[model samples]
Target chain A: MQLSPSLTQLIEALRCQPGIGPKSAQRIAFHLLERDRQGGKQLGQALTKAMTVVGHCQSCRTFTEQAQCDICASTKRQDSGLLCVVESPTDVLAIEQTGQYQGVYFVLMGHLSPIDGIGPKEIGLDILENKLQQGGINEVILATNPSVEGETTAHFIAELCHKYQVNASRIAHGIPVGGELDLVDGMTLMHAFTGRRTVSQL
Target chain B: MQLSPSLTQLIEALRCQPGIGPKSAQRIAFHLLERDRQGGKQLGQALTKAMTVVGHCQSCRTFTEQAQCDICASTKRQDSGLLCVVESPTDVLAIEQTGQYQGVYFVLMGHLSPIDGIGPKEIGLDILENKLQQGGINEVILATNPSVEGETTAHFIAELCHKYQVNASRIAHGIPVGGELDLVDGMTLMHAFTGRRTVSQL
Candidate 1:
């Protein structure tokens, strides 16, 4: 189309975003040029700044500009003696939304997958072990997903927690709160039955 | 979630894009940080450069770093004297993709919408009038959309063409080639009937 060099470059660069294809990249480029130059400027400045300065939080392995994330820096959260292990930073955000948990978090950033060359060390289990060895946490909640990889990762971490004499418990997995029984899959239904709890003592 | 300041700002800035909601913004931010920092950096640089340097082409009003767009700068296209008037630069791209048109373009950048206070000057009709007055263009093809606003804008331009003794023609409207009769809307069917052309003189 003989598009301007800068316009073409902008479209090409927009393709870097996940789920954005060629058509979407073109649309986004045109939209920015036509409707929102200011927004384009702001996004550019933000991206440049973030990519240059933002780094992993040393304490929790989540994204942060500081040495430790806000939650990891809070003395009260650290003093709670409860650490939740998760697969990614997004999981921490989801759990925070629930507002029930009072603890710090350790983000694996990925699961333990040998085929992908990811192991305990890859998911920062070494850092987790170091934290546990310091003898502050009383319990470690395994909030990884219920997938096979998540289960294996949780089990491996559980073994490590046992070695440190810290209590390790897997988060419950079953049908969700409002899920229908018939619509639920066989594996989930089995897990629901296997993990059934008494509603009334009588 | 007590997200890091840069991460939070990146998410907020991402919302400036079209069709990106909160979840999509968060997902895009995380995806870039986790896997495509290089891409994010390139996108940032591209966006910044494009926003700063890309101005409207002096001749056609399409985005360009140069004074004239590549198409406008081409001697053959300029000499063809067949000007395609369209609502926006995207329309120019669509036409160029067809590989049929061999002409220059004049981008309105938007269709006429009187209630929105957009008049002739706003859509650069004054510039178009100046071009027509200079007297070299032979045909002005109105390739605006088939919407009411598009039609109104084309009609207004058509009247302007008559003042300068330039022939103006609107692009065809009717059922698409692969479209089904049953699936076609009444207005389009009516257009098909009204625009019907004879195939043979049998």
Candidate 2:
């Protein structure tokens, strides 16, 4: 069936979202035009404003309206000598939600994917290296995902920390806190067994 | 963690889409600002344009950029005297996709939900009554859904047709074409049995 030109354009534009398909795009377009034009206008204005004002934080590569993010600018965080590196801004939010980490963060934006031509520079690793080489950091934590590319990226960052003479640590890999052992995947089971610690350490 | 003001607004606006929640909205907002700013701008423009241009079709109440929709304006559709009444523009699209029906359509936009303060006038039943009373119509097909509200709406429309002395027919209720008998819901099974017809009728 033929749609109006503006409707077609709206559907096509909506397809740029991560999980949205043509069907979903069409549904969203119709919904906006039919039921929620005011909401649609609000969303459009918000998008324009965000695109205009939000940019990568100069210090940590997280999204921010200013040069440095709130976390990077704050003096209240206790562990100023420790840095936690992650693959994305979303990961930073996830870690922060725990309320246990007092250190600052470095966002890589993406993992190292050689097949996709994403190298160290593409993910802001050079900036991280520069931060480490400035000589005040005591420890570096690798908090990338458990994927192969994440592992490669973490190893590369670990080597950089070693060269800078800073201690390096990887986030533990095992069954999640609420997960059943029988349901845990084989790779995670093996990692858990190998990374097991004494009761005193716990 | 606290997000920038514009970033927060963008995330809130993204929740206007059908299934998106807080986490999905955040992900979509970040994706637009970080990776697909150009696409986001295009979407914003499309939304603005669509909102400015599109309005309800005069004859059928479907979304259109003009006074009449493409289907309503077309001369090739055979059944001008047959009106298929349905509950939303999306349902009109669903029926049109079958490529079987050549009749004109009347979009109710909603069902008769008195509890929600939606009565006959709210769903354009008055306009439908006027169309039926004008006397060219040979048949009115009740193509509303099979739920209780849908049935109530369909029956109401059928009564309107009877008042105008125009023929009224209900869309058949039965097992879906590819559905397994054992897997069909009890309500649908009862509807199928009750709606059964002779082979010669087919």
Candidate 3:
């Protein structure tokens, strides 16, 4: 039961990672010491550097070391006059991987969770409203997740777009391509049916 | 896309932990940035401290920040003259949890792993043999895992124990106490049958 003091602290600190529990924390600590000390050192340095340097982008609220994020600083993306709003920086990565959208992004950092005290101001909705009022954006695409909070957030932003007289559209909700319909949940199936389009005409 | 440099480095560095993949790395990074900045900072500091300071106990080869581990440093455990051989420090923790043994430990750090270029010297068998030759230990319990490599390593060490004229024993391998009979594997069942003793006499 009496492990080394620093090893115990390592285990305790490793539990801070999402989904990592006590057993996993211990396992990770032992593994790093036994097999990957160099990597462990590098990870420690990276964490310290990132925690100190990484900050929210002034224009989009995505993580960046500079005042403005790379996407926001790009003239090409800014010239497009299109802004796709998402819930987190990872969503920006997910959308960027597709190479489909040429627009810049607005990251909310989180969805509105009223019970948790998250509201228009908490998720940077006030920043978003200011951007909308400035009037360079031609359209705002609500690409938040399909959860209930995401939907509510999209609706709220859509109303904001209406107030600014800018166009707004929600991303489609339906069965994913190449997935079997039988395995799909009822809520998703319902969304697929309700959001049907005139595909043949298009 | 172009993620922030520090954020990207943090995600890449997080991959060093066992079982964490790209998506998990990104999720952890975002979770830390958005929710647990304080925990992330603490983990960073802890990792740096542990990786630099923790070393193997000289007496038992388990992790410690000093010359010997807590159990190995204790006079009572040293007087017991019982040394338990195991594959890793975690195994030491596991055995200590049972509270059925009052012995010091000799951690092998790994099993035989010959295909991976591991040998007797690599797992600190040289150190173990030296301890056996020192003439204080009365019994050495081979508590390595039941896998093929562990068995091979145990057999190899049993020979070393024989040369030193030290008493050696292997821990019991059988169906777990709370496990159902139908769920026990064939190999474990065979071990149970082969190692069965007269319960009334025991």
Candidate 4:
């Protein structure tokens, strides 16, 4: 059917979302036009504001409106010499939710994917290397995902940390706390076995 | 964690969409800011354009950029004297997709709900009444949904048609095509039994 030009434009624009398809885009467009015009206007204003105002934090490369992100500016966090490197800001939020980490962060925003032409510089690795060479960090934590690209990025950063004589560690991998052994995948089970520590060590 | 003010505002604005809660809103907001800034900007422009340009079609109350909707303005439809009354613009799209109905539509956009303070005038029932009284329409098809409010609106419109000396008809309610009898609800089964017609009559 020939939808109005404005309606069609709205639906097409909605498809930019991660999981939204044509049908979902149409549904969202119609919903906004029909039932929530005020909400739609608010969303438009917010999108414009975010696009114009939000930018990468100067210190950590995470999204922020100011020069540095809250974590980078805060004085409350302990161990300023410890740094946790993550793939994205969302990962930063996830780790912060745990409240166990007392260090700072370096947000890569993406891992190394050579086939997609996403290299070290694309994910701000050069800036990370500069930070490592500047020599304040005592330890570097690689908290990237267990995927192949994440592994490559983590190893690359580990090499940089070694050159800087900083301690580098990867987060442990294992079956989740409530997960059953039978449900655990073979790769994870093998990693668990190989990474196991003695009871006395624990 | 303290998200940037603009990021938080964007997330809050995203929650206005139906079925989108806090997490989904956050996800959409981050996706726009991190991965699809161009698309986000396009969406904002689309929203602004739609809000400024789109309005109800003067004839049918369906969304259009013109005075009359395509269907209402078209001379190709077979029955100019037949009017199908539907609950929403989406319902109009659904019927058009069937390729069966050749009549023009009068989009109410909502069903009558007395408790919600939505009366006849609120859903353009008075406009429909004026159309029926003016007397070009020979058949008024009540295609509102079979819900309580839909039924009430259909009956109300039917009464108005009777007063105006016009023929009124309700769409049939029956077991859906390819649907098993066992899977059908009791109310629908009852409706099927009561509204049954012989093949010869058909």
Against the true structure, whose DockQ is highest?
1
Go through the candidates in order and give each one's DockQ. 0.78, 0.71, 0.77, 0.75
- How far out, in Å, is residue A69 in model 4? 0.8
Off by over 4 Å in 1: none
Task: List model 4 lDDT by residue over B99-163, tens digit each.
Answer: 88888889999999989999999999888888888878989999999999999999999999999
Model 2 chain B weakest lDDT span, ten residues long? B72-81
Per-candidate TM-score, chain A: 0.94, 0.93, 0.95, 0.92
> Which has the better TM-score: candidate 3, or candidate 4?
4
Tens-digit lDDT track for model 2 on A1-202? 6878888888888887987888888888878877889998888888888888889999899999999999988876524787999999989989999999988899999999999999999999899989988877888999999999999999999999999889999999998999999999999999899989888754
Model 3 has an lDDT value of: 0.91
Query: lDDT per residue, candidate 1, B1-202, as tens digits?
Result: 6788888899999876776778988998888888889988988999999988989989999888889988998999989989999998888989999999999999999989989999889999999999999988999999999999999999999999999999999899999999999999999999899999989977
DockQ of 4: 0.75
- Every model's TM-score: 0.95, 0.92, 0.91, 0.96
Question: Quality of candidate 4's docking, in CAPRI categories?
Answer: medium
Candidate 1's docking class is medium
Q: For residues B1-202, what per-residue lDDT tens digits would candidate 3 score against the true structure?
A: 7888889899999876787888888888889888888888888999999999999898778899999888988899989999999999999998899899898899999988889999999999999999999899999999999999999999999999999999999999999999988999999999999989887965
Global lDDT of model 4: 0.88
lDDT of 2 by residue, B118-137 (tens): 99999999888888888878
Docking class of 3: medium
Q: Give residue B45's error in model 3 in angstroms.
A: 0.5
Compose the digit string of candidate 4's lDDT tens values, residues A73-142. 8876534788999999999989989988888899998999999999989999889889888877889999
lDDT of each prediction vs. the true structure?
Answer: 0.91, 0.88, 0.91, 0.88
In the range A21-40, model 1's lDDT, one tens digit per residue, is: 88888888889888988999
Off by over 4 Å in 2: none
**CAPRI docking class of candidate 2:** medium
